[model samples]
Target: MRNVKVIVQGGPANEEVRTLPAHKKNPEVGDKKTVFSSHLLMEQADAESFGDNEEITAMDWGNAFVRNKKTNPATGKIESLDLELHLEGDFKKTSKKVHWLSAPTDAHPLIPVVLIDYDYLINKKKIEDGDDFTACLNPVTEYRVNALADANVEHLKRFDIIQFERKGFYICQGTKDAEGRMEFGFIPE
Candidate 1:
């Protein structure tokens, strides 16, 4: 052969989908690609958990609650939900920028009321009116606040594969297995 010219060029290879663990904080979660099926660079991510090269794994989503202080028109009373629950272990990861959620400095405020009664409350789960939920650092956006008026941000029965597209990151909430536990995802996107 006299001569031949070839070119090999590309960015890092993307990973394929895989079954992530139900528990987010599982210590055995080694490398991300070692577990996660997808690893796209999150636009508002604080830092990739694995590293600049490795994508974060064991991601989760939840319907975080916010109790906006407001006076009830009918009663002219300020009835407040009085219980807050922060999952120390299950809240596997953290981030600084949550586009969907509104930070304190954001222009808008959270919905005046809990648009959808938490899944626990609807099932007669006995959530008291005076229940206090974790204070939302990133308040739910005005659009989300309004949308929630009709849209029920229901709970995912169990941990399932979450995906993202041009629209946004989506949590697939149809996991058949259930431990009968109710928890909210508080991390940022």
Candidate 2:
């Protein structure tokens, strides 16, 4: 079997679908075999807890929320619904798509890649007539994460642009360095 590095981008912050817990055990999630399953990549413990529970219904790609369950005075729920919630299952239905790269092996080796992300240089969205531009400057604007890219990245030279699926487009910084590190700068969408 080919070892693929599945990068799950957008999803609810709930622990059920977290990579730390869920994808750790089953790495083949979102693959062709179980791409359309409602409970794709759900943690074993959480799936067991929800055994036959009627309050919460697992929707596409293991996302779940309480619909109409009534329990006494009940605690409040913070409803944070992302517009991209349906991005996981049924390729025909989801707007966003998940990207995967081949894992490194003797036969099919992958390149070591660094993805650089950036936030706005300014903290304020709009500058009014008398707004102080210096004060509104954002202190932290750059973020970087290490990733493994498919072997095809080796052909990319400096300034080559490539889209990282749901992550957005990125420009190649340069060829692999002395440490075999290929860097890409994220271009804001």
Candidate 3:
């Protein structure tokens, strides 16, 4: 038989969809995905050792954009974007970054704000206001209570998920309820 020539080609491998603990039931399909957009608040601080040497020179607060994708919309989809929350203007004079949580409750909306301090840095970090940073918002569902409980127990690190009738990615930050129930303050993105 006559000799035949063959060729091989390489291309980007297709990645399998990852399932987060939240979205384990009814996964989002096709173009049906949650798109979140919101204005975020950020702060910046100074870099120094202990003593009076530590001081904030600038402060800034501005709006930012946060985005994330939902591979499976069944269990729960938390925010997975890693964007620096920048603080400029008056904020720089005080601390680093701060995040707030907003959510609706039986009585009213739960809004809790927290101040984020820069404990340490690597390679002289650089950030600015009006700069966009990605953040995760937890989705609101029946599982929220359990999730928050786990979070309070330290079983979960951060509660970054958002759930609204139309909105997406939101986080929960604040104290527990009278029954030791954890409430979420969703930062819309």
Question: Evaluated with TM-score, which candidate comes out highest?
Answer: 2
Q: What's the lDDT for residue 54 in model 2?
A: 23
TM-score of 1: 0.19
Residue range 110-188, candidate 1, lDDT tens digits: 2221111112213234556665443312243322111211012233344432222123333333321233222222223
TM-score of 3: 0.18
Which model scores highest in lDDT? 2
> In each prediction, how many residue pairs overlap at the backbone (N, C-alpha, C within less than 3 A)?
13, 0, 41
Task: Give lDDT: candidate 3, residue 22.
Answer: 39
Local error of candidate 1 at residue 95 (angstroms): 11
> Per-residue lDDT for 57-90 in model 2, tens only?
2332432322222222453322111112233334
Off by over 4 Å in 1: 1-14, 25-39, 45-189
In order, candidate lDDTs are 0.25, 0.47, 0.28
Which lDDT tens digits does candidate 3 get at residues 1-189? 011111101111321122233343445621222111122111111111112322222111232222222222573322222223223335435443332221123332323322221222222244456543332222332233222111112222356443422234445454555555445554533
